[model samples]
Target: MQPHEKVKQYLDTICEQIRYKRIHNELREELENHITDQKQAYIAQGMDEETGTFKAVEQMGDPVMVGTQLDRTHKPKPEWSMIVLTLLLLLTGTFIRLYTAPRETNGLELFYRQLLFTVVGIGLMTLCYKVDFTILGEYSSILFFALAAIIVLLMLVINPVDGRFIYASYPLLLFPALFAGVVYSMSNRGYSGVILCGIYFTIPLILSLLIPNITITLFLTLSYLVILTIAIQKKRFKVNQHHALLLVYVPFIISFVVAMTNNNLIYRLKIVFTPSLAPMGVGYMGNITRGIMKGARLIGQGALPENLQGLTVEQVLPLINSDFLLTYITHRFGWIAFLIVVALLELFIIRAFVLCARQKSVLALLVSTAVTLTFAYQTLGFVVTNCGFYLFAPLSLPLISQSSHYLLVNMSLIGILLSVYRTGHMVHDKRFPEKPDRRPFLTIEDGRIIIDLHLD
Candidate 1:
């Protein structure tokens, strides 16, 4: 039989048993190329054509086994480590609420609500994992504009409840998705890619400023810097240091200048930098928080500290269930619990970075890395603010905080990250053609085919 006919027969047998038909053509092309190369080597060594083809086929091992092995390698699998860590964090948040629930406030009720949110978040995450993340890349422009419009509407229409502005959590939550799309769309474009990214970034920046939520604005700005840096590092965009610095610092300078004019912001800055100068009425919370943290020491006050048990939420610490939850944890459960929470957060962020490194597609890499930075920055901000380093933002810890919007947004981002991880290595024939096998298992040396069976 001809070499081509024999190869086709073998491929047909292998593909027949393979479960995933989508990869059948790719696997066939790879095997054919390897077999063809092997046959050519045997012919060069003076073997007859028919014998060369037969020998090449013989060396490929069993078709069924090869096909099954390829299927297993390409199968989609969840990152269970991430899922478990997320659940653990969610449980910890529940424990904190139960332990610190004031007599007037229903602790059990809050825990049930948090549990419901966790269940919903996990379901959404699973859906994201199963779907093709690259599809988001295709519709990035539409998604960005839609999200941008939502932010604008929220800014104009939503009235502040209790004199506090509502955060743009929906827009911020969807930022990574919109970002992944933008990055994918501009992947091969040169300088234009950077320009397009900058334009996409402006929408959130403007909306956050309009809401006068400096915290969200700062978060968005930092996210933009991270995305830009990753793009430059990946060689997707070429940017000089001067231009990169301008891209980063220019907006920040402008924002800082604009923020200085607001009296409320000026007061927050005083609380952060010069607490002694802060007004006695409003800035007293910083002092109270410091006292609470100091009283906790190495071990916390043991679930319900006698000193803090009877105090109401307003009297104990403002925003205890949301922004001040970590502080409350330290005050009630002690530094050890705080450290445990921080440790878990570090693991989550590190895992994200590891996943980002493993991504083969540039768009996935950008999206995953952006998600990692978003979490990292928020965690840092939360910790810093709790430690009394900065008093300007009410940034919540990713999964440990009790805000419904914050929890849902962060969980959705985690879902997108998992999606990117699952689809990172997928390759399509149109975009990435199969290359000649160069795995170093076999080589043509001195006009002869040499197979190195020894594992390195």
Candidate 2:
């Protein structure tokens, strides 16, 4: 290929970097229009039309540089602090889980699973980072449909055969599906797209209520809603300074009323009200609450026999390993460790939101919002439930769980981050001349390689 041909290939790749269908259409139109304008200018410069066009194209700068620059203008500066915080939190959580938790028959096995899962998740995250997330828009609907099918398989197909299902380990895939839907819809239809995406997730969530997997259902639905809320908020309040704020509690009010009227809901609500309620129900939360409370007394010494009594030795907490991993932290590492965990979670979420705000493409922003919502809501739910209220079952504990489902979910979030960052960094670091690599060259029948150089 000639020099100009190489340039065209590079531009095409850069355009693919921010590859939303809507944006792609716009970029194509823009490139064609620019090319035409350039050709006209070349003709005016006293040269043969074709020769003028060729020289004009070369003089305008490489197409790749132009396209890459456009993409970069929309990227955000990397936040190193959040990355460090996430790493520290994940590493510390793993250490505490391995060394501090009470031993059981599956002790070594569980530890191995947790460690292996983390490695696998990080690898998956790296893979996600390798591509631009905007490419995910094309498969958003498929992903949503697949998740729905999987939910069905777990509830109907797998549960019956195994007497249980493994949804908890990685129910977080709901975020990517819902997020992709939001990105696609928002680009095509604006805010209404968001509302439709919410409805899409909500329907399955309500359906899941009766499927013995309410936690996963609720988690998915809540994540979708939270993301939509962010979009709505962004629409309501653009950047710069905020004026006055009116905090509304419409959903909270409705939920409170519903719980008050229903006995089962009331029982569930009690979990959030009193940690003690856990012991009376499934033994998961109750054990966690009792263990954390007891563990907090010692704060870092763990639940050794010598200090067990001092750390609420009389209390017998159940499920100290999984749902109640927080308790294990308090028992072994102390309240400080628990606080650090919370801080790290908050930092991870905040960083995600920042990415959403800084993204060049609307789809990336919305997807980032969805990812943030999923992690934030789950984190809040986990914390609120563990604080003494036993309102819900133990969901996957993010980075702490050995469940394959949870592990995948956590990795998916990381994937979103890394992918977005790769694109985002380019936008931030090189706003002037972003370009992709050149295309492969081919020999022509003539002495020189001939190339048809359409800007688009």
Model 2 TM-score is 0.71
Decoy 1 TM-score against native: 0.75
- Please state the error at residue 18 of candidate 2 in Å: 13
Candidate 1: give the clashing pairs.
Answer: 300-333, 300-334
Off by over 4 Å in 1: 1-66, 102-108, 149-168, 238-267, 279-282, 302-314, 425-456
Estimate, for each residue in 1-456, the C-alpha lDDT of model 2 and write its tens digit.
133453355446657765333355556555656755776787887778668657666666765666667666645444566557656656866876676344544756777777777788777776765655655565666666676676666666554434435552255355444555443444423323433555566556554554546566666655655555554555422211111011123443576588579876766655555544455565455545655555365355455334335444225554556666666566656778678778778777787777777776555666666666667767776776565555566675667543555766777676766566655434221121223214322236668864322134
Q: Model 2, which residues run further than 4 Å from truth?
A: 1-32, 42-48, 61-83, 160-164, 186-195, 232-260, 274-295, 298-315, 401-404, 425-456
State the weakest 10-residue window (summed lDDT) of model 2.
239-248
Residue range 1-456, candidate 1, lDDT tens digits: 343788889999888877656567788888888998998999999998789989999999998888778778777666788878888888877777666554225555666777788788877766766666766776788878888878776656777665545755445656755675686676544444556688888887777766667777777877777777776666554434445445556766887789789998776777776554553555555655665676676884733334556664347676677677778778766899889999999999999898888877777787788778878988998987776555666767888876666777788788888877765676441242222223433457899986543333
Which candidate gets the maximum lDDT versus the true structure?
A: 1
